[model samples]
Target: MMTDTTQSRGRVEIDDVVIRFKGKQGTVTALERTSHVLEPGTFTSLIGPSGCGKSTLMNAIAGFVTPAEGALRLDGKPITGPSPEVGVIFQQYALFPWFTALNNVRFGLKQFGLSKREEIDRARAALDEVGLAAHADKYPQQLSGGMKQRVAIARTFAVEPKVLLMDEPFGALDAQTRLVMHDLLLGIWRKHKATVLFVTHDVDEALLLSDHVQVMSQAPGRLIRHYHLTQERPRALSRSGNELLEIRDEILGLLHPKTMLADTL
Candidate 1:
């Protein structure tokens, strides 16, 4: 979805990643030998059951969590820790309560050392891209849940991170709002050209928004399958073609126990 110039912004390589956590039950393997490469500026989604380490892998990419054994590289450089070039958007709005939407979005730009005017200009442009320019003066408490998420989105893209890691960003929205956010996300993604790795449990959402959907198995997660979607952008579930439905069914068969049972019957 990226233009030629910004196409080089996002390129990621995950090599033989293994993640583990310490629990009362002992060491828990969250992910095992999982690896993948995301091409520059591609929109990819990770879909799987809860606790299957989809978020764990995302956190690893965001530099929030370290892989017990593996490597993560962005643009051919090893990712040692969180950097301005990588941005994250969680399911929670995570907006500062005291800050206006405009200020919240502008906060990340301070790291760039832009003068007061330049920071405001970039932040305004980001808000405009997400259709929230008019609401810029509103605080998070004054905005709806959907609007709050839009501001979060505006904040992430304002700094133009090379890679955007989204952890179920629209999971908290209602059905109608989720659909609206899908379109909004695609528009901004195309415009910014940041390599996007979206994590979602919703099969339709994954297929609708991604160029490729990677499916992970239950706990001790591994890359079970990956589907490359052929549908054009601005996609809607109702208007999806038969091919899309077929792929959806196939992914469903892998993720849903009942569907998997029926497949063998």
Candidate 2:
């Protein structure tokens, strides 16, 4: 698996990249001259103040946005557009409300026009992987926040994507639900071994789920700090205590100055 970036025995590079958004006022710089490297198979979490353009970076890598400057590549292939090779999961879950969980997973398989039976079998297996086979027949509205996210995770895995892009997938959940999702995500990541770049504002959430925490600055967003989590995988919430909180506070210390001031006062 991947490890520390500096000690990255195997390095992955992202050359200069810049992204802009058109606003009523004018074009806004969401990211600028941003560049970083990630080790293969590593889980990296992006954290920063709100409106820091974390999601923008995810969109850029997912090929939803064209960078005005530089490019992104993986395994040496330049990323120019969205491909099944990358799977993106957002805070909204993005599961169609009308489709049952099973149908959603099947929808991904059907993209290649697989037989109905094969699709059913694959969807079932993917749901089972996320411990949600029993809920396969349920629709998104019927499930709780955690279950819907589980279905989202199942759908992403069903496609066997090369990478998973997550934008605060658990930010909307309750504390208890968030912890459960953390365990579920780590289990799935360990099993699937897909490269995951998770974006979150929750410092503890990032520390809990990522192999590395990438702290970005506010607009004109760019990496300000990165921490390699040497902690073992499959680590649990109940299992983590003071040390985890320490890491969380360290990240908080590095958050945007305004956020720090707001938190202090």
Candidate 3:
């Protein structure tokens, strides 16, 4: 597709952000003074145990959640709320079942006040980029799980958002499909070069996909560990061997120390 690479401008700053929620029982601290800088056009992944606040932190970046303390900024401006500049993709392919793939993507462009022709053209190009141009007329029910996710991705990228926030997008797919999605995602990512913050529970997935992986500690999540991947890109799942395995084990141990200990025993 014909993405305007110049539109990409994602740079994020999380400064000592602390998120707390007042529940019926008590105030639960979801995140505690967690901070990280997401460089523009870089891919960052967040990984940790179930209750660890990875998703909470991602929501804060997406402007869906407010921090109890500190701040969040994109390119030096405070994030007040959700904007077209930041796009979010969740695990569920939230495409409209009634709409065709092309129209679904076009729906997102309507907010930009594009002409009818412009919207159609852009949407078509986005679907083309994801290798789904031929399926433009198909509805969600006509597509497979992976195809639906691609349409979802195409919809997000169609707007050319500066930042992309993803929550377990591939978690629903089978292992084979997940690997294929991984490659497809990386290809689209390199073309767009938007700042990406991806949240996942899979350590190997984090290692395979991100430029840097931030591991949050158990509940009341903190930035417990950071892994910077040195391997070159265009990496395949099969190519992820020794170094990635070692890092995966290290992250696994961090996320599941008690389990690792029991296994060693």
Give all TM-scores, in the order shown: 0.93, 0.89, 0.92
Q: What is the lDDT of residue 22 in candidate 3?
A: 97
lDDT of 3 at 41: 88
lDDT of 3 by residue, 186-238 (tens): 99999998899999998778888899999889998999888888788766546
Put down candidate 1 lDDT per residue, 114-179, tens digits, no spaces: 999999989999899889999989989999999999999999998889999999999999999999
Clashing pairs for predicted structure model 3, backbone only:
none
**Which candidate ranks first by TM-score, i.e. highest?**
1
Least lDDT summed over 10 consecutive residues: which range in candidate 3? 1-10
Candidate 2 has an lDDT of 0.83
Clashes in model 1: which pairs?
Answer: none
- Per-residue CA lDDT of model 2 for 1-265, tens digit only, reads 6544443222335689989989999999999788887666789999998898899999988889888889887656678898777899989999999899999998888887888888899999999988899999999999998999999999998998768889999989999988888888888887777788999998778887888889998777889888887776666545766676666767777784546644663
Clash pairs, candidate 2, are none
Q: What is the C-alpha lDDT of each candidate?
A: 0.90, 0.83, 0.89
- Of 2 and 3, which scores higher on TM-score? 3
Worst 10 residues of 1 by lDDT: 1-10
